[model samples]
Target chain A: MKAIAVEPGAGDPVVVEKPVPEPAAGEALVRTLRVGVDGTDHEVIRGAHGELPAGSDRLVLGHEAVGVVEDPNGTDLERGEVVAPTVRRPPNGTNEYFERGEPDMAPEGAYLERGIVGAHGFMAEYFTSPAETLVPVPPELAELGFLVEPISITEKALEHAQAARSTVHWEPESAIVLGNGSLGLVTLAMFEEVLDIERTYCLGKRDRPDPSIDLIDDLGGTYIDSRETSVPEIPDAHEPMDLVYEATGYAKHPFDTVEALAPNGVGALVGVPDDWSFEIDGGRLHRELVLHNKALVGTVNSNRGHFEAAVDTLASIPGWVTDDLVTGVYGLDEFERAFERNESVIKTAVEFDTR
Target chain B: MKAIAVEPGAGDPVVVEKPVPEPAAGEALVRTLRVGVDGTDHEVIRGAHGELPAGSDRLVLGHEAVGVVEDPNGTDLERGEVVAPTVRRPPNGTNEYFERGEPDMAPEGAYLERGIVGAHGFMAEYFTSPAETLVPVPPELAELGFLVEPISITEKALEHAQAARSTVHWEPESAIVLGNGSLGLVTLAMFEEVLDIERTYCLGKRDRPDPSIDLIDDLGGTYIDSRETSVPEIPDAHEPMDLVYEATGYAKHPFDTVEALAPNGVGALVGVPDDWSFEIDGGRLHRELVLHNKALVGTVNSNRGHFEAAVDTLASIPGWVTDDLVTGVYGLDEFERAFERNESVIKTAVEFDTR
Candidate 1:
């Protein structure tokens, strides 16, 4: 079986040969069809984030995955059924968070993400997972099913952002996404189509004629160049934002989002930045948050419920939008193209098999 | 009528004589009884914060007030009724926040806090306010009704902190208050008595025999001397906190509170800090918040609903606790004693008239 693997503190991911995995009791063997590459994958390759599996030198490198159940092994899943595997699994086989069906809320060292940290991922041709960890995906959407994982992240982030205002009669009219990456564009689309936000904006440093910005315009969203106007100055440059979705992971965006918010506004933080120390007006930020009745909620990862929600969101998004997002889908023999970074690229994936 | 007034950027408050005020069509003339002094009063005196009423050189200084309605002037309030006045009023004739019955959520400049910012306070012997701004109080609570204003501030903060967890099943077992001032002590008592939080803690940097420490001990809360254990170190020294109530306006406490929270914890920030610049590990704090599913909510002034809630909270507290909190109740002639800051003082107020 062919698999994608990365050596911590080493170079980029490479194609490796490994034996096919067998399903244990109450487990299902899956034959991979598609796997997505994201920012976390880049970080894991650079040694800035994620841990290698215990006693293993190289870690498998895919979490956003979709496949067919090759063997159900007497589980609820049926043979040849399409499914998407969730990333997080209890590290010690049990914890309060896992017991509560909220593994996404588990603290560090309590859970391991397959292909992310402390476990092997599903970038291989064959992988085995507990039957319950697999979420059934509609067979007709197999071509785009790999996206359910990334979309789930946004689903969880928005869930928390809305939860912050549950006590108030909040009707958010405007929103801004702090990044122009694939996730940002997808979230901006969700903001327009699902949330029906009146005014939408996305921030990026890209020049005109960029596909990402074009997609924003196609979705009726305005694109603000970061070099021209920063996050904190957005209120004066445009309008006070009712919701600020931060996906850039820039250390300053969190503070800036507090200032950009209108009264009773909430900001959802999803980016994970590296160690960076800087000077900030702590008192001013604190005063802004307190005086404005603003809230900031930090979220990462997603649970099964979010993934279920993501399926519907993915289904509702126009086909052309997803078509524009996936710029390249490389086969195992030419896997290098999936890891390539280019200005024109929006989203990339590695194809294991079509059927 | 005699009043306590401060000339902004000048010096401490001084006694001034003015004509008794007349109530407008929908206004009520209140005979001030007890007006509590707090940190915001100190800031207004130092010219560091707050605004003087338009076209007025001096600002009357008292917002935490309880009084008797001297005249109803064709309003819903009855004459001779005990009431506590809310502080915030729309700066303009009206705003959306005020229209929605949420003046506390109004942004800066949209609202004026009576006595604290753009309007005359209740420190005067006679003050005029719109009848709707006064919340009726039980006559038996007249001696302790002045505490309602400050208690309502905490009420609003806790409301927001709890609202942040509305989406999840949160049972906060342990809580910590990050200050030992009057507000901190009152909030600690509320956590134990009202919220029924177990394993309460309060942080202060005072020597033994301190009155504040004694009150915390009386409430069955552990006292953490901040000099011995910093805010971020509370998790290791004591235990990870499920709820962190920040009352000290120290700029660093906000960031430290994020680090001190347990997984799925939420923090409520109530203190207003002055403009100060500081260095922090922005990346680590951001990561901690996102990965641990933590949230931070900032709250300031409270609405009438919170004041009504505070009335109940105040009545439920033991009489000895409120008695021990109000260290002094100075008359007009000895008003300086109420503004004095010393080691033994827990809470202070100025009495305009007993009847």
Candidate 2:
């Protein structure tokens, strides 16, 4: 079997040969079909963050993956069926969150993220996982199934945002995305496909003619250039936003988005900003939050329910959006090319063959 | 008639003569019995903030007040019935929030606070307000009724905190109040009276034997002298907090409190900090918010329902606490003495002969 491994602290990654894994009872052996390359993967590769497998010098490097079930050892899953393996698994021992089927809500260091923390990822040719951790996807959408993980992130965030605003009769009329990356585009697509929002906007630093902007425009959403227009000035230029989805990973955009919200607004933060300190008008920000009844919530990974919802969301959206967004697909030998930054690239994947 | 007025920009305040107000249709002529003085009143008097009433050189300086209805003017209010008047009123035109009975959610500059903004207040011998804005207090608790307005502020903040955590089955066991001011004392009282929280702590810079600390201790909650301990060191010294009610108005306490929250905690911010900027570890703060499933919500003035709730909250609390808290009750001529800040004073009020 071929797998990509990175040293824990060393920012070097290479493809190496590994023995194929076998499924234990109630587990399934999944042959990789395609794995999405995201920012977290780059972070792990650069040794900025991520944990190594226990007693191993290296960690496998992919969490967003789709695969074919080659062996369902006494499980309900059928052979040759498509599935998206969940990234995180509960650590050995019974935790309250894991027992309640909410491993995502587990406290810090409680659960191990496959290929991210203390376990192997799905970038290998063959991997074994508990059958319950595998979510079925349509066979006709094998390549596109890799996106379910990222979309699930937004699904969980939206679920929390909806819950936070449930006390008030809030029906969001206008929404804005604070980033133009693939997650932002997918979030905008979800806003169009799943939510009842009417007006939409996506803000990014890129200029016009970019695929991200074109896709936003195709979804009947406006694209705002962040380089030309500042965030605080958006509400005045357009209308005060009801819902703000922030994915820029900028330390200041979330605060700025808080200022841009209308009365009774909610800001859903998915981006993890850098360790930078900047001066903020604490008084003014406090006033906006208190007087206007605004709420800001942060969400990271998704639970099984959110992933299940993401499958439905992905299936309902027009296929062209996914086809247009997943701009590049490479092979095992060309895996490094998938990590390269390109202005036109929305998403890229590394496909696999089990034969 | 006599009223306390402050020159908008000048910090000087004095008792001045004014025409007695008459009740119009659906309005009540209230004979003010007691006016509780809080920090916002000090801010208004110091010229740090506050707006003058239209076409007047001076602004009446009180928002936390209790009065007796002298003239019901064909409204539901009865003569000699005790009432607490709400501070904020809707703007001239019919705004959506005011129409929907949520004047507290009105946009900035859309609503006018009675003493803090462009409207006159209830610090006079007589005043008139729409009968709808007057929440009735039990005639038995006349002087104690002035505490209702400040109590309503906390009631609103707790409501927002409960709403934000409504998604999860959160039952907080321990809580902490950030400041030891009048609002903090009232919030501590409410936590013991309204919620099922067992362990409680109030952080303040005051020395022991202070009335505020005494009240907190009497309520079976611990008092932490913040001069000896820093904000971030609280949870380490005691225990991680599930609910943090911030009323210190210090610019940095809320951020440090974010670091002190336990998993699935909620911080209800009712404090309006000064215009000071401080450096914060934005990355760590974002991680805490995302990973721990914590939420921080800010709340300001309360609406009619909150006032109604506050009335019940005040009634349910023991009479001795209010008696100990409202330490000073000056006559109309000695009203200037009410504004003086003294170490022994927990709450000061101006009383009038309304009988």
Candidate 3:
């Protein structure tokens, strides 16, 4: 098997040939399919994320991938069936909050190796995982199956906003979303369908050399070039946002909308802002926030409930995710190109040449 | 009529003669039985807090008070009835969230001429207020009804915690409360009766400074002095806290036991730390607090349900607040003495006769 491998301490991961893994007693061997590149992967690769353990060499660094079980795994999985397991190993799979029921607490996240992290990842020809780790995907989910990781994030965040439980029939109070990237767009899509939000403000790098406005607009989202617009000065109707989603991963901090929250509004943090340590005025948060009864919540991943909601949502998405957002797709050998596209382009996919 | 009034941003208030208030339609003329002074009064005098319109002075500073309806001038009240309202006198008597069950957003709070806050407060001989502002205190509740305001705060904090809704039953969990002031001991009392926490650590002012220890002992709480023992360390079997109430008002500061929270723990905050600015590594809070599904909550004058619960608890208090916590009584004319005793007292009652 060919896998993407990174040397310990730093440096670009190399895609190299490795032996395909066999299923252990409680493990499931998965044939790689679609692998999604996120901020976690880039950090792990650059050694900024403290990914590899003491003895590990080149590490595997992919967690968001959809694959099929190749081993007749022991618990809850069948060979040759599509699944999207959150963890790379048994106990520590996923992040700390990704429990099965509370999938948000899923531990043992996969980001160490395609052929490296601690175990091999799906950025390779094949990867091995535990039996219970898989989340089965249907043929209807083929194009967007790899997105379960990010989509589940949106689902989990909406759980905090209760975006899905809106009762004004179809109209939610207006929403302003900062960061028009994949997560932002997906979040906007949620409000678009699940709630009756009259308008949405997607604030992101609209002036990027290669912009992603079409994706936002395609999802019926209105884009705001944060570079161009004064976010905080967007008038009271927009100033005091009904909801604000911070999704810019480069420490996309919530500077504008936190205090700007409508008296009893809600702010959901979905992006994992990397390498930033700042002070939050708990008093001001209490005074201005709890005083007005505003809330700031950090919601990580979703539970099985998120996956189920995403599945139902994905079923109704315009073009159902096939029309756009899946910019490019390549085979497992092109792992580097996949990451390169996520950087140079935005939202790329790694398709497995399963046949 | 007499009122204790604080000039704008001054340190203490002085009693001043004022005309008896004429009740407007939908209003009531209530004769206060007693008024309670609190840290909120401190905020008002020092100008740190007040629900005043811009550039206003001659503000009264107390809000926690009890009285009897002298005349049901226009709406919903009868003559000679004891009552305590949840402190509101909204301009138009409504605000965004309060009409929707949020009292914290009330526009004009009860802090005016009655000698306390926004609207006339009850630190005076007679306080004019609205009929609906009254919360009926079953006559049996009179002797201790003045304590309702602080109890309302405790009620709110617990209600915020119950939103998690997991630990409704008395789980075998311990709590370490920071500070042994009124809020602290009140919280201890709350845990003993409402939360039923197994072990409670009330870290007080290096020594059992006030009657908080007695209150805690009365409520069966363990007292700790951070100065005496190394709070950072604990024997493993000594259960980590399930809930921590920070009543000392330290803003943006982390508690020593913050890192000691078990998975799925919560830290409820009522303290208002003075410093307005500070910083923290968001990742650490996520990894340390949130990722493990730990919650840090900011609660204030509680939601209505907590208010109801708190009243019940206060009513169930063994003595009618006379024997222990309530240390002295003074007239509104002795404003300075009342303020002095409020600083050095557990709780004090304001006698209206001598004013």
DockQ of 2: 0.51
**DockQ-sorted candidate list, best first:** 1, 2, 3
TM-score of the second chain, cand. 2: 0.97
Which prediction has more favorable lDDT, 2 or 3? 2
Worst 10 residues of 1 chain B by lDDT: B161-170
> What TM-score does chain B alone reach in each candidate, compared with the true chain B?
0.98, 0.97, 0.85
lDDT of 2 by residue, A179-221 (tens): 9888999999999877858999999888767898899999999
Winner by DockQ:
1
State the lDDT at B196 in candidate 3: 74
TM-score: model 2 vs. ground truth = 0.92
Q: Which ten residues in a row have the lowest lDDT in candidate 3 chain A?
A: A163-172
Candidate 3 residue lDDT tens string, A1-355: 7777676456787777778877778778887777877666777776765455447576766667888777756767877787776643323445433333454543224223332245545677677765555677786675577788677777767665543112111123767777766667666777776665777777776454444676666667677766666555654435466677767643424434556555445566665554467766645554454344444555555555566666677666667444466667776555567767343365776676556
Chain A TM-scores, per candidate, are 0.98, 0.96, 0.83
**lDDT scores in order:** 0.91, 0.84, 0.61
lDDT for model 1 comes to 0.91
By lDDT: ranked, best first: 1, 2, 3
The backbone clash count of each candidate, in order, is: 1, 0, 56
DockQ of 3: 0.27
Tens-digit lDDT string for candidate 2 (B1-355): 9998888657666888999987888889999998888998888887777787779888988899999999999999999899999888876856877787888877778899998899988888989999989999988878789999999998888888887777666788889999988889888888886785889889998877688888998888889888887778888999889899989777776677778888778788877766776677777777677767777777778888999999999988888878777878899878888988887888898887646
